[model samples]
Target: MKRIIPFILALLLLAACGAEPVEAEASPPPPMPTASPLPDYIPPMDFEPVSVWQAEHFSGRALLYLGAEEDGVTPFKVYSCFMYEVTDYLDGNMLMGARAFCAEAADSGDFSVDCSNRGLWLEPVLGASALTGKLSVDGDRLTLEYTGCELAAWAEDTPGFEYRLSGGQPVIDSGTGENDSVQYLPTEFKRLPDEYLGRAMYWMPMFEEEASASAESVRGLRVGDTYADIVARFPNPLDIWSRDPRSVSAPDGWYDTFYGSEAGTVFAALFYEGGVPSTVLITCCSYASFQLDGGLNITQLSVSAR
Candidate 1:
């Protein structure tokens, strides 16, 4: 009787276990492709080929680096920083998905790590800020070597602030499927209206100028002021806008709007001071430039024609 009871319990256990799909077989994933060897020093250094090799085995994320160390070594923490994917659009400033930077080794046992211009680039962050220094990855340490130089991307003025000239660059990933490269989160595009999407670029809804919050004003600052005068008064509001943490990027770089917009022939140049648009207009040039953000430059452009 005891033997019979044990046999019944064993059958019950097998029945509770889910059955596997015997009919359909799972296929194995394809192996990653390998990159070719690098040559001796070249004038315009190319980092793409080496980037491919680094992506294969990179397993860290949101890497943290130590502050400017006299020693070349910078400490890092793993947190998954495969950020920044570039998406192609017709014109103006595009979104900031950005490519992830990767690391690699050279032939003859020489090792080198360089920033990834495309694909899963391991982003190196220090504390809360992204390091702008020349970036590279090796083992658990991420190295940032600053040579004090600004290489104009492709000799064709960088597309816009924080944008790199991706044209004339090597193709790394197809960017489809799980491994294939594609545009930035298409979901944002899907939700946008057709008209808004059709245009290469347009001003995003920033804020309607507030009637108040501006306490004091600089004397002689007014509409129809020369662009030079505005610069003189503020020591370059555009530059201030670029560096200001509170400020957001306009499609064209420094200023908020391009030459002309809803404000008729008058152009708007935004420089924010504590999130308030300065109320001064820059005139005398073909385009009307004015501060759309802050306490000096005027935000108000158009008035009822008398």
Candidate 2:
């Protein structure tokens, strides 16, 4: 329905809770604060980072920032459309939002970066997306001048997107979902010399797409995982917060809840129907909800329980 927060900002909000060690090393739940800013805790990335960047000073304008070189990481701050979210990033649709994972350089010293992986819980939302625009750095200035988005294939098996079905067909809203404003066009960045990963922002900044298949789980818990597994993994009560289920996105017997239980988390919710996890709701991926011709459920993926 109405948006409480931006798609995945919830993960940014829960940047701490989801990272707690499982049962054995689990500690007692701390006093639940009413509010908290983002935290500083960088875990080892499962994938190699091409150009790791976190926005040092968000201009709140169109300007981008680049971080200085340190501990094998660099913050290549790129501009995402401020008005709207990126579409189907994990479903193979990328935009300027895709984190730079590929690097290429020519004899003239111009460089380009291909971003594949994002930070935080979204680290798994990666694939070859069409909107993988490179930051062409000609000498000192860097610019993302690519403007392209893939047509929504409306495929049945998108792990990182969701579509609502009406009469077995998607209710297509007619119009271009693109932002024609100049602010959304190609942008430039001013390089900065600082390490703000753990200081300025809580985690690595990243954005995603609209194809569907639930890609988020608490403590790496996945679909088909047992309730015992959830309990064992998150022994702390506050680790996952059970919430009231809504008929719009819920299934039978399953009550609704979220992976992160802090103030700003609504991105990823878990559905338990008295057994193993039956469904997972990733509200953070897509922008406008698309109507699908065939039926689509709230991202029931078969991710490994192992």
Candidate 3:
């Protein structure tokens, strides 16, 4: 038997693009001109603040500036933080930044604040841990002194910056309070999957006979003896579609045939595909609801209310 030895080979290719060195002497081109500074370099500060705050024991820093009152009267509070892109400021300089406010309250622990962001609430750190008596922004840093301790924070005009705790020798991270540096970044809240509905659902065809039954029962409703006929089965009797978009009162005798008189007749939503009955959404109460998952392909005469 002749055995075949298949030849396999791998090729490696390397390409380099470079300029060849020239021995010919030539005058060097004049040094490229440097760009002149802008005539309107100082853009006026429009401090018409879009937000304000009052906070305490503030650790984390965001797009806005954060601070507390210097008075030793109140506990601690955190107001609001600003949000902005970090790339819009001088490179590596703290020229651009945001600001927030803070207040103190004795009734609730040592830390409390009434600001635009959190409204009115108590912060986590309390008493001596409240961080400062009050806070304010001086140029690029937030300056504050509390409980015989003083600290400064440096933040750029950018959105998310790593804020290191100012003052003292041990060194500390502002938000985490750990000896290890902590970084604060910008983020936004997410939304629910469905609107007003507590759960997710899907619609599909039920048993084949059920759809045929619907098609038959709805035959004489001025629709062809087809999927169109199934849709005509559900008619708008009183035509109450002009009501308000929020509240709706069910019509009398609406559910008499299905749920009986005790079921409290109410209006339900009917869905159709290609002008044919497909799904029915029924509301039992403000919270509880049912979805009839069936199309023209239905069969057995039964309703599973969930």
* Candidate 2 backbone overlaps, count: 25
* Residues 1-306, model 3: lDDT tens digits: 133322221111111224455688866433322322212111112222222222223432222212232354432222222211222232221111112233443432233232223211111121112233333344434334333222222222223333233443211223322111222222211122222111110011111112223322211221112222222232233443222211223343232111111122122353444333333432221111222222233232223222
Q: How far off is residue 60 in model 3, in Å? A: 7.7
Local accuracy of candidate 1 as per-residue lDDT tens digits, 1-306? 989999999998897786664666755323222212211211111221111111112211122212222244332211121222334432232221212222222222122333223112221211102223344545533333432222223212323223221333212232222111221210000112323221211121110111111223222334534233343332232354233322343332333442223222123345334443443332211222344333232454432211
For model 2, the local distance difference test gives 0.32
Alpha carbon deviation, residue 278, candidate 2 (Å)? 19
CA lDDT, every model vs. true structure: 0.27, 0.32, 0.25
Residue ranges of candidate 2 with Cα displaced over 4 Å:
1-81, 85-141, 145-175, 178-186, 199-282, 286-306
Best by TM-score: 2
| Residue 294 C-alpha lDDT in model 1 | 30
Q: CA lDDT of 177 in candidate 3?
A: 27
TM-score of each: 0.18, 0.30, 0.17
TM-score of 2: 0.30
Higher-TM-score candidate of 1 and 3:
1
How many clashes (backbone atoms < 3 Å, residues ≥3 apart in a chain or on different chains) does model 1 have?
35
Task: Show model 1 residue runs off by greater than 4 Å.
Answer: 1-93, 100-168, 173-306
